[model samples]
Target: MEYLPLFIDLKNRPVLVVGGGIVAARKIKILQRVGAMITIIAPTLCTELKKVLFKQNISWIEKKFQPIMLDKVILVIVTTNNAKLNALIYQNAEKRHILINTVDDKNKCSCIFPAIIDRDPILIGISSCGTAPILVRILREKFESLLPKSLGFLSKLAGIWRSRVRQHIVDVVLRRRFWEKIFYNGHIATLIEQGRPEEANKVFKYTLNNDVGNNNKKGNVTLVGAGPGDIGLLTIRGLQVMQQADVILYDYLVNSEILDLARKDANKICVGKRVGDHSMSQKELNQFIVRLAQKGNKVVRLKGGDSFVFGRGGEELEIISKAGISFQVVPGITAGIGVTAYAGIPLTHRKYAHSVVFMTGHNANGDNQVNWAALSDYQRTLIIYMGKINALNIRNNLIIHGRSINTPVAVISRGTYQNQKILIGTLIDLEKLTRIADYPSLLVIGDVVSLHSQMHWFGQKALNYCPTYLIAHSM
Candidate 1:
């Protein structure tokens, strides 16, 4: 982020090089690839620039570094062996507010050349702000091998059919989904590499024609879990469905980075619900998703955590089935498992707890639904979701039902995220833990909670100023 990456059009643009040595020749060769009108300002020419002088559209000025050479030029390059002369030209370009690159000098450089992986129209630039040029070159070579040479053919084909796609698929979202489905799945690329562009065009036309919500088209709905606030926890199938979705209905708990993986032009609507802040009622949302799928639009219901575990996915799918809509469920890493693992708390350790229970703190009827008798077992680890608000109730009920007040407990908030925080205490301090914890937090109550001292790994990266507190709390 230190330098903003840019790809400028240098075709036929006027540019000046203030030296005629090998380094200057290197810059000139790169400029030549972009077809820049080059003017070399130096008293003598090296073997490289002398050979370059034979090329057309290249002008040589047999003179020392002069201030007038930078006038009316789009860019400037200072590659002279004389350090003072290069600095002088750099200062002149800076005064004129023109982009300039002083070779091997980061401070004097207004721009720096990047290691490029060129696949014709598909150009990938790798740079490290001149700090690690060798590392960037290695990365460029890796990308050059990973990306196929036929990539440019696919991009160019998309360009040629862009107007035709727009004409056929009236909806912008549908058109983008059409392209994402083809390119991301590598079907069009394979056809082009096989030298069957006519077949590729036919595939494009067929995809576009079928995207108009016709009655013959039966749309699909995918219930995908986005995982607990981390893009890495998302299932491969979940990411695929998101990329192919024409429309996505995501929850508030879903990570913004996970949502960014969807097709660029896909319609993303927030159906997210907070504790008391409901954007859309679940009843209305269930019906709305079904309606979208019935209309031949591929819809994705993106929920946070596992779709089946307290995510109300079954209720939504039941409604989808009643409406006779085709649906698929892509499971995701539930917070009960993923968040606990990140916090270094194992749900069931044979020496500490032989059994584990997954429960919700808040339900439709408030607090009466929980079976405290079954939950008070000594050898069981309890994982409670949406339990921050009822932490006091849970503490009192478990103690009243024969669970020990001295049992270890932990409250983890925003788990698996960079801002994740963990608070460790005993069941007696559960109310205090709730006061310090945020909403959408998880509660781990059992002897297994004490094992966090030995197993703790992830700490809040933003808490670098309080290292002592972090270590003391984890211990």
Candidate 2:
């Protein structure tokens, strides 16, 4: 983030070096490989630099550094031992907006060089922005050993065949798939490594010809849980499926950071449902998913929390299954579980609660209304999802069913996120306290809510508000 890495074309470009020591000689030799027109400004050259100068064509000033020398230079490398001179050069270069590197001084440099792995047309540059340089060198050495010397030859051959391959395969995705098959099929690269160009060309052409006719490809449909608004809570499998997805249909509950993990070229569609806002109906979504998979797109349906827990994942999967589309599901942490743990209220404790129940507040007065009379036990914990809007209905129903009006309750907002908030109060204050709690909040009721005071461990990152002064004023 501190510095953007760029590969610039310095071929036949003017460059200035401000020292003639061995350190400067090392950098000059690297510049020479890139075909830069290097000019050296020093009183005299060391033995190493003198030998290097004889092997390459370079301009030698044979005098002290001056400000006028920077006029024609595209880049400046100050390898001189004098800190003041390096600083002076950097300041002047900054005014002109020219790139400059001050040998061991990252603070003075506008740009720094990276450790490179050169394979002709393929070049890899690794840098720590001039910090921990030894680590960069270790990485470069490791890559050098792992990469075959024949890679450059393979890349050149692929370049030669690229135009022909594109002409055969019209679609971009199919063309990319074709190249992937070629690289991994153990034919083209292998034949070239064996020094048989004719065999490689024939094999490559035959594979392309056969592939052009097989256009009816099938793609997968994956249901990934975005977790409880926490990127870290997302499973590793969830990340992988997202990266490979060709089209992703995500909900509003998903974390924005999690969506950023998908490939840049992947099509992203928002099919999220808020408290009262629905982007697409459940029936429409199912049909759309089926259509996308039938077209051979890797469609990922990303939902928040566990897909089975109030996420309507099973309903969507039923449609896909009936259509004979290949599908998978990646489970995530549900809000009821993830939020309570973060709020320091356990759903079940041997000493406090024996069992826990999960339900949605959306059905408080609906045709599918829950039986609250059986949930009046003081020892059992009740966690409600989609409960923020119906906090009054939920509280009155529970109280009327013999649950204590004074039962401890906590309304949590943005669970498991960095800015999560927990509002503690009794069942009598549930409606009032929840007024300040943000949307997509969870309501926890039982003796376990009392543990919030003793077990609050989210530290300074979370805000805790009890039904003390704020509720009385807000209500």
Candidate 3:
């Protein structure tokens, strides 16, 4: 610990700044936000500083620095270009016992500006002891993405309830436990973020009576969709539940990168199921989740894409409900919609196909349950999920049932991911197009596939895909 980290309240306090350039203006802005009464002593003020002169807390003097200006000043900031002058001011402030900060000079700084994430009433400060400023900046960027923007609002709401909570609970240990329970309940945060303050107040009041220091410990479960291999696409509500979860059960397709965002102490269990690989039966997994929740653990069943879309989420919900467990679902962007957008293939186009159908090609009985005749219409787009192994059957059925052999087709594997691959061909070449691609591929049939070349936008090599009939379409 090279420097002791402390957050001092500077509201309505006198502070002096010894320069008026852009850097100095930045320092002034931070001070202003903290309600500091600031005076800048310099020959001229920068354009930014000039714009804020009318502010009640800011004052400027168009004069050079002098020792007498340190009188009654609680702190001083030196941002001048001249090293000698900045050092002179630091020495003068030091002799008078006034704390000083010199911009870009760690030795002269009695205080250094830390990287701040201001969720007002809740501020997170990060510092590298002024040794690794860039590293600290990178850390700030990472946190900026992980933290919800509604955090400040949540903090403000908590502050509003503090007095009431303290009055009702009375005991210090009980009050602390009560607040911890509130933080663990994702529903309360969801209500506050959704602009439902009245509903949120009701929940808070309910928790105060039923949950505060109560021995009746019954935890809940949340079904969260991880989306299509993109951590940025995870919902705010999903992130909140993940952070609060004591145990997380994830699938094979759920992005590992997204799981890294969860609490470090969380227990992660791999209940992933593939086509022929069964980690655990669906019934067994459901019982496991219920058992964990019954023991008062916050359990999150994290799946890939929309859990309702062939993710067997409905089945799990049924099982959990039968077990008398509380559960909620946080929907995610399903592959039928998300992957098509990334591959630049619209599921429905007015000039091409108006109606879009999403169907599963991998039926458990290995039978063609979908109506090939109805889907053969040229006016509709067909999006088949997990259709790679059954590509030959799908092609034969579509062509045998009035579809054109020359109809455009596309197979997108690992859509919206860094290693995603797209293959283009006609219906006659459907099997060939899917042969070289990876599993979890999406099969798109109809004239909409022609738009892939025109709308290709997701990855760097999107336009560089191998195609059997590139000459039939315009690139």
Candidate 4:
């Protein structure tokens, strides 16, 4: 609350800059975009500013700072290195009520530069009151990734349609709801993204006329991958879907904290599945999704890792498709890849493993569908999901099929999380090593497991783990 945040229109207004250095050049470019009439008062201009003085309609007074220069300007920017001269300009500008911003001097600044994310009309400003500039920069970078580049096009299109929409929909609430659907549908945005503006307009008009405003609209289902255990692993699209979800059906592997990303009023249901334990049967879950979508509620089927990778995402998608429900799949970082990296066990290495295969150990009685003979190839790093219970069988069968028992292995549980547990050993002690891990664990088997000793990296555990004992520990 030290400084009030405001966006001032500098269009056609004269703004004075006291320095011609790189910092001044940077600010001048921003002002140029906003159609500001810039005038610089510097004894000598930098090479960049000299180029700008010639190319742009800029006025430069090759003279020292003086009080008379502040008369015509509405705002003053002091990037001058001379402290006494900067203070003189600030005092004079303040007397005339002219907004002044002194570079790197908060006390003399009437305004400060904020980290701005400009998606045209979608402008977001982040500031730390000039206290933590680096933190502000980092936050801005993160926001830059989180926000879509096509947002400007989307906003412009929305602006163009505003009058037409207002004229058609008289009611304020209904109009707001219509805009929400228009934005959330992403059809127009996708068309714009794919460079089909004419088709986008046609669809936009069609959507406006035929579909929206009422609760009778077909609900959407976005299958989001909650990668491994770390919430950061979730994709930007997945986070957006979660925020828009009217109902979220999540699994046991999904971090509970991820559920908080959903809309405040969103209905969250735990349909998590565990081995030999049923929260809601898969059939029941599929039916439930269809039932919810039939009632026009945006449903988000949140699963851990990549939903397509042994997460039974394909099964759910098939059911949704057959039901004629619109669905989107936001692919996640599956545990096989995400967990191995977090545990510093490479799925493929140049010297150890040339290929990697991911599989599931969970199966019903009499299900011998596994191709263990092919999986026994040590050259292909094998990543097994839910293989904790069947560790003994996997270890013995692989060895029985001529695989070396001395092959290195690592069992990672709740990978990418703070309390994640990882035990390392060889195939000889696979079962014993797995016994230390809980559910939602992965088995990484190959010579690449030996690389864990070299590249032991992650958050706390990896950073603090003793590399000396990486000689393969068992239970």
Instruction: Return the top candidate by TM-score.
Output: 4
lDDT of each: 0.81, 0.82, 0.84, 0.82
Per-residue CA lDDT of model 3 for 334-442, tens digit only, reads 8888888888998888899989988887851235577778989988999888888788888988888899887888888898997788887888888888888787788
Per-residue lDDT of candidate 2, residues 1-475 (tens digit) = 9989899898899999999998899999889988898999998888888876755557788987778789978999998888788888888888888899998899988899999898878888999998799999899976775555666877887898889888987889878777764543244654554467787778677777774646455565889888898788887667766876789999998999989988999999999988568898889988999999888787899999999999999999999999987677878889989889888899988887999999988888633468888788999999998887788888888898899887888888888887888877778888987888897799999988777777777733225455452353244
TM-score list, all predictions: 0.55, 0.57, 0.77, 0.84
Choose the strongest candidate by lDDT.
3
Candidate 2 residue pairs that clash: none
Q: What TM-score would candidate 4 get against the native? A: 0.84
Per-residue accuracy of model 1 over 143-238 as CA lDDT, tens digit each: 664565667878888888888878877888876666665444434544564567787777667766663443244566889998998788887667
Clashing pairs for model 3 are none
**lDDT: worst 10-residue window of model 2:** 460-469
Off by over 4 Å in 1: 1-216, 363-368, 460-475
**Over 4 Å off in model 4, which ranges?**
1-4, 43-54, 58-63, 95-97, 126-150, 180-200, 211-215, 363-374, 459-475
Worst 10 residues of 3 by lDDT: 460-469
Local error of candidate 4 at residue 364 (angstroms):
12
